[model samples]
Target: SLFRILGELWPIFGGNVSKPKLTDMFYIPQKPYLTVGTLRDQVIYPQTREEYDELHDSDAGLAELFALVRCSNIVEREGGWDAVNDWIEVLSGGEKQQIAMARLIYHKPKYAIMDECTSAISIDLEGFMYVHCKKIGINLITVSHRPSLWMYHEYLLKFDGRGGWEFGPMVLPEGYQQGTA
Candidate 1:
């Protein structure tokens, strides 16, 4: 599936075939974790500790990023922004994905590779997230079987499990327009 495509594509993009450039791109698997660091640490990645310190000191910027992902309430709900020790344990799957998306929005990477990462999220919210990401110029390379996601993307990079793949513009339904859903 998509993982295989990513496995081979990672090296050309930056790292070993199995891993991509962690510093700039967002890579979310079906299962995500907060063990990488605190919520603050997760979103401010690629930024130096000094840069994180600057944004943390400013506060509003970080809060706004969370708000953009529809997760500002969770910071307080889970005890506070910087205090969530294990976000995966405290938050649900959808919440974890939202956090990942928040990081993407904050970083505004040119591209992201997601593998069924938003499986737990409602379609409406997922669509909103995609729209917002597109608005910020983030090109998504999503790996999902959900046709519901097709409207948000412009191309299809299909991998046929048997060591073959195809790439082309996405074909939408008759009378359906991109980004209309």
Candidate 2:
């Protein structure tokens, strides 16, 4: 199901991709397929309402998640965590990205392909996303050219655009090398 989503969304910004199969992938696809349910579902996506209930979902937990993503104000303004509306109509770009990060952290998949998912997010929230992924031991493949993100990686793969590429330990500007900055 998610592979089908990859097929749909990848072409918008990614290079060509073949039909993905479960066997060929490194990790199992455990994240729920994105769905439009309640406001809570927005943050714990791919999970059905029944699964959410069986997992003992709580407003306190949802509140904590909202706080971590720096969007609890939305819930506060909406009256409470139970307020379910069209978030897409209300959320800003950065807010949407923050929600995505919250969903990713909640899912905590073994592997994630974060293709510039944080581009719309602030650096602080982006850092939180990175830190949370590390804490959960998620193997992250972040596709971005933003220099600020270079510090998070041990290895760097630079493409020269003429079909040439360089893969080695990251080499960044002074005060920003791995383990230094």
Candidate 3:
């Protein structure tokens, strides 16, 4: 149920624009009754159902979906549903980052570049997102300073900060690899 809800809301949360065809994405084969509208109604409010449903039927829905997923918690607290309204402007930095991520996921790009995109998020949340990305087979090029972030990547590119750089397979060092150039 949660997965269905996530699938329907993902485009809205991610602000996708590339037009999702059934052939491009994979859906878990199970109950054949789960439509986008059913998923939306389950996770979102009934009053907001029409708006969420309308988003799936149009290209511009991607942007609107992104706004909703990013601001949904805040909007729900204040009793508002419109993702493009005044609520978006007041979201916190972390919330904004989440919104940006939601947009990217919605777009479902063949390749994604994450340039310090999760700087504002908690480490656990970032890890969770990365796992999801991997599950979906979205090729990601992530740039982050956090050592833990490297665990998600298959390769590593290190800049020595002295006009030198190294790129290769990631190796876990037995001890801190330090040198002065």
- The 0-to-1 C-alpha lDDT of every candidate, in the order given, reads 0.73, 0.65, 0.52
23-130 per-residue lDDT for model 1 (tens digits):
446666777646645667666655666877755666687788787777788878766656747666777787888887887787887778878978988777888888
Considering every candidate listed, which one attains the maximal TM-score?
1
| Steric clash count of candidate 3 | 8
The lDDT, on a scale of 0 to 1, for candidate 2 is 0.65
| lDDT, candidate 2, at 105 | 71
lDDT of 3 by residue, 30-83 (tens): 111112332223223222656656566643444355444444564455344333
Across 16-86, the per-residue lDDT of candidate 2 in tens digits comes to 55544422222212232333446787876667667878987466777777788888887767656556777
Local error of candidate 2 at residue 38 (angstroms): 1.8
Better of 1 and 3 by TM-score: 1
RMSD of each: 4.1, 5.7, 13.6
Ten-residue region with minimum lDDT total, candidate 3: 26-35
Counting clashing residue pairs in each candidate, in order, gives 0, 2, 8
TM-score of model 3 vs. true structure: 0.55
Q: TM-score order of candidates, best first?
A: 1, 2, 3
Models 1 onward score TM values of: 0.79, 0.74, 0.55
